[model samples]
Target: MSAKTATARPDTSKPPKKGSLHHVVQVHYLFTLPILIMYLVFFIVPMFMGIFYSFTDWSGLSSQFNFVGFDNYGKIFQDDDFINALLFNLKYTVALVIGTLVVSLILALLMNQKIPFRTGFRSIFFFPAVLSGITVGLIWNELFLKVVPVFGQTLGIDILSKSMLGNATTAFWAVLIVNLWQGCATPTVLLIAGLQSVPKDLYEAATIDGANAWQRFKAITVPFLLPIINIVIITTTKAGLTIFDYIKALTDGGPNKATRAVGLLIYNDAMQGGKFSYAVAESMILFILVAIVSFFTIKGTSNKEAGDA
Candidate 1:
């Protein structure tokens, strides 16, 4: 019989300390607390308060307010201007989204190619994005008022002197055109960045696979750029919904409120008309509409991403 010695086994069965997890959680909370607090203060709290005010008869300036309980919301639905403004805003949002995406995509593709003066072209494309909406509106107003007439005179057309914003139909189209022109630049820049980030090797591989130009673009470029495209769509949609400056400067909800957006209507109700609670209700409704539309849009995009993956 030999003496058997048992080797000391390594301690592999010890449980992790609860204190370690607690410390990690504490560290994460510490890092995230400031952002959470800021969001609550700036966004969450204000949003809830707005919702509350939407149900009240608060005149915005007065400290006293009465709870009206959905009457304001009911009035918003009944108001013809609110209905028209909502419709106009919807039309504008749809047109702007489609126009901006189409134009930006085309510009991005062109700029991605081995073209001369690419830097200059890019600067020209993106320059409008840096300008304030009010500035863009003012500049375009002058162009429509002055430059168009001069051009029209050179071409011998008298109709060019007519104010675009003076007619209901014309004012709507004018706002849409101005929005598309000024807004396309940012998305163009974003799409260009997305395009550049796509691997060149993927295109080469597609070419090797006998893929045509359109096929390569459809399969490779678009798929790779879908994430950025979603971002651009969300951003542009929100911007379109919240647009106030250009509309204020250009039409001021004129032509019998033909070009008035929900934002403008809300402003008119609150400041111009002194229907503060009603404006809050209108704002809340607009906010909900925006949130619902955006949610659906994002969900659809996310589903596409999942399917692609």
Candidate 2:
């Protein structure tokens, strides 16, 4: 026993190695490297290049070009076509955002009820979102051009057979309608999720308190769904701003460019007229517009939420 009573010494010579910290950092870098590389290569580089080229008179295909400074931007503002196109895009964004939100919310409410074949109805509503935007546009074009006429002939309704893509006013509305049809599906799905997340107990309590359906919805559902509504509006606005495929397919920014949006205008400027620098300037404007809109929309919604809270 006496021989085994040796004093124990503390081993405090060096700090413990942070192997776990190193592992965690390595894991994070490994996970993020690919995405960072992709962003640098695809988005960051192109954006800088576009900005650089915007100051120069580069016609895309040619190597020989000269610096033009703010001339392209000045021309963009002066061009009636550009102004009209921007206005058209703004109108399109407003119309699509409002229409899609309202329609999708209604559909979500209906589907949330105890209806027959709810899954089938959901699928029917969402099927359009699965189709390519160009495909949906083309299909709607045919319907407006061919099927509408046949249906009108059968029913003897002259208004039903009119060329939707012919006149400026009608063409704009036609594109808006097609956009609503194609885009409403995703918003509906989102609204469905939001609706489902809402507490059923709130409705039950409201009913017990002698509240009518409209009062309950106004006081409860709308308040709770505000976040989702904001999301839908932002998504639809961005989509509307950058809309190209459907416009290209359905109207080709035609009928005197009445239905043209910003994306389509940029594409036309770059590809058709060989105005690469001009298009880049237009794109920069668009990017600024989208960034401002998104920031304000999000900030407004956030402020509303804070006020309500």
Candidate 3:
């Protein structure tokens, strides 16, 4: 009877081997497959292709080209259009980073207070950020071309009489202003988030210690806000460096190309002028410039914060 009761049981001993395709398909692959596929098809492939093409004189159309190494890079230094665009980009970046930070920080501080209709005000301020870059550019284009001219005619003001985009001297400023208006909204929101995340106990403690408002801000607020500030600066700088959509939509690198940014220059070179290889090379240079600027900015701000602490 005891022998007859003994029975075989099913084995539940081990897991599937990770190296098996079946295991991969059944476990982690589904979750990460889409992102990995997209990354490979879009970013990784394009980057390598761009780098390879940069050394060649390949037209955007055909594969036939000479691989003249370093020639494109050397020629860039002598290219006046590229050089001017680079310089203009630098100036635009500086103005954007400084102006956005100043305006956004102020707005963020003001918005942080327990004021009436603060939520409504935030919506109003952030409204522009949701608009299409091209659409915003077109709207501002009308303001500059039509509305401003009408005001100028009524007031007998000379500078506002013409389309600001048509004037080389003022075109750069007009583009910068439009970008500043659109750009500041995002940074303000980010700074508002940063301000909200700050612990209130530190402020309370400082207040109890006879700290004035300015002193408390200087001592506690700035230190805490430094990380967000640096993040804003980096992102803003990158935007300025790679500025394209607004400039393209608004100016199209016109008014004698005075408002031509590096982005426009590259786009014109690749798409418009059919100098794809040269454009790729120029893009590489811009990449280096962006990296250097970001590194220095982050290093400087972080060091300053550490010293203050």
TM-score of structure candidate 2? 0.87
Tens digits of lDDT, candidate 2, 1-309: 644433222233554544344544678789999999999999999999999999999888897999988999999999998999999998888888889988999999999999899999999999999899999999998888978767867898765667778878888888888998879999899889888888899999999999999999999988878887888888899998999998898989889878888898888788786788999999999999999989988997897676442
RMSD of each: 7.4, 7.2, 7.5
lDDT of 3 by residue, 246-284 (tens): 888888998788889999899888876568899999999
lDDT of 2 at 169: 86
> What is the TM-score ranking, best to worst?
2, 3, 1
User: What TM-score would every model get versus the actual structure?
Assistant: 0.82, 0.87, 0.83
lDDT of 1 at 111: 97
Give the range of the ten consecutive residues with the poorest summed lDDT in model 1.
1-10
Please provide the root mean square deviation of candidate 1 (C-alpha atoms, Å): 7.4
Clashing pairs in 1: none
- Comparing 1 with 3 on lDDT, the higher-scoring candidate is 3
Off by over 4 Å in 3: 1-26, 150-162, 295-309
Query: How many clashes in each candidate?
Result: 0, 0, 0
Whole-model lDDT per candidate: 0.84, 0.87, 0.86
What are the runs in model 1 whose C-alpha is more than 4 Å off? 1-42, 61-64, 152-161, 301-309
Off-target runs (Cα >4 Å) in candidate 2 are 1-20, 23-27, 61-64, 153-158, 301-309
